[model samples]
Target: MFAPRVALASLSGESDADWAKACEHPAGAAFLGGVALDEPTREAARAMVDRDRDEFLPEDPVEFVDDQLSALDDAFLRAGVNVRTVDLDPLREVTEVCASHDAVLEVNAHCRQDEMCAAGAGESLLRDTARLCEQVETASDAGAAISVKVRAELPDVHLPTLAQAVERAGADAIHVDAMDSRRVVRDVSDATDLFVVANNGVRTREDVFEYLSYGADAVSVGRPSRDPEKVRAVYAAVKEWFL
Candidate 1:
């Protein structure tokens, strides 16, 4: 949970320590990376790059995570890493680094890329809630605070049901990327006690207020995160609302 309740969401290839730093002025937490953690996911990321997309494809994924987090050693705000992997082993490896750094390990189930879904990660996890819950439990067992980043409005995927299962699996938070269905935040929040961080289209104070009104514990800035004025606006909205 963050102070002013504004988090900087992970942007495909650009989210790193420097990106986080640039957006951290008024954010309580920064969820960096949607980093590819295993060979399968890395392969998918590479394929995405082939199509002119961006992704974090480090040679040594876990080590890269450790280094990125270490760069935030003196940061005043909380740090979190959103990770992608089809294998549990790599996820466990990254979770250890997150735990050591006292950072939240966010399991990425929000990405809608065809490449990611084919790799059995990203939005594919939404279709397999059981696998997603297992990831949350795996991260928690590694001594990391767990947050599952999920997308809304996926076909045949009941978010409220998924949220309850994730909570039971030991996730401390659920980051909801509510794609045009902001009310989904309320559904997830009402379904489970997991801290809900609502995301998508967050820019102004009104945007922040709308998500909070729908039961989000926090709201995150995605595309507009690099804009100081937009991030500051959400920060001010949080401060004012909580006052």
Candidate 2:
């Protein structure tokens, strides 16, 4: 989906400036959102959007989402950046918005937050493989190049099995938050034809190379992207290694 082999993973507080910084880098792709699709997911997005406060009280959920998407579109979409929006909602609700904006739709199954999991929207999906596959198929059917972002190490969840299921369900790519287990990326890559994007704990060029060596088609930088200089360093390292 991206020309470079490096990507900026979805992070909190992804403002227009954040997207611009990512575009300034040579990273292959930049993923925005991790936005809530429903009440369950909304709680988490509320926390991020209303940080420093203990509670989130929105008068209208629909308007809240519309406003959020509008602000994001205004800030980042026009930049011509290859951006994808990660969402916690079902495919049917989020697909059209993505298509309307020409943004790639990424289904998030990697979040470990209690609220999201309780709502059956995040890591909880890992255990519900059937439903996860259904979501991917729905997005793909809607003509979006779908990507499923999954977390590794979920109890009773097999990375390869999930990866293959998503691939068979028509997902274009699988973004794995390997979480200390690079083997998950390797196994997922080996098990599916879908493009594999490896995430977690990537700090240096060597970290990027290590994931690629482990069979990741792309490596994602998360926390590091908060610092433009660090992102630039990674971009420089990737260029040196790949070019």
lDDT of 2 by residue, 1-243 (tens): 765666777764453334545454466566665556555566655654554422223454334434544544644222111111224244455565555655567777887766567767778888988888887888777775778888887769999988889999988888899887888888888888998988898888788788888788877777786776777677776677766
lDDT score of residue 198 within candidate 2? 88
Task: For each candidate in the order shown, give its overall lDDT on alpha carbons.
Answer: 0.90, 0.67
Every model's TM-score = 0.98, 0.80
How many collisions per candidate?
Answer: 0, 0
Model 1 misplaced regions, further than 4 Å? none
lDDT tens digits, residue span 115-212, model 1: 88999999999989889988888889999899999988777999999999989999999999999899999999899999999999887778888999
For candidate 2, give the lDDT: 0.67
Give the CA lDDT, 0 to 100, for residue 81 in model 1: 98
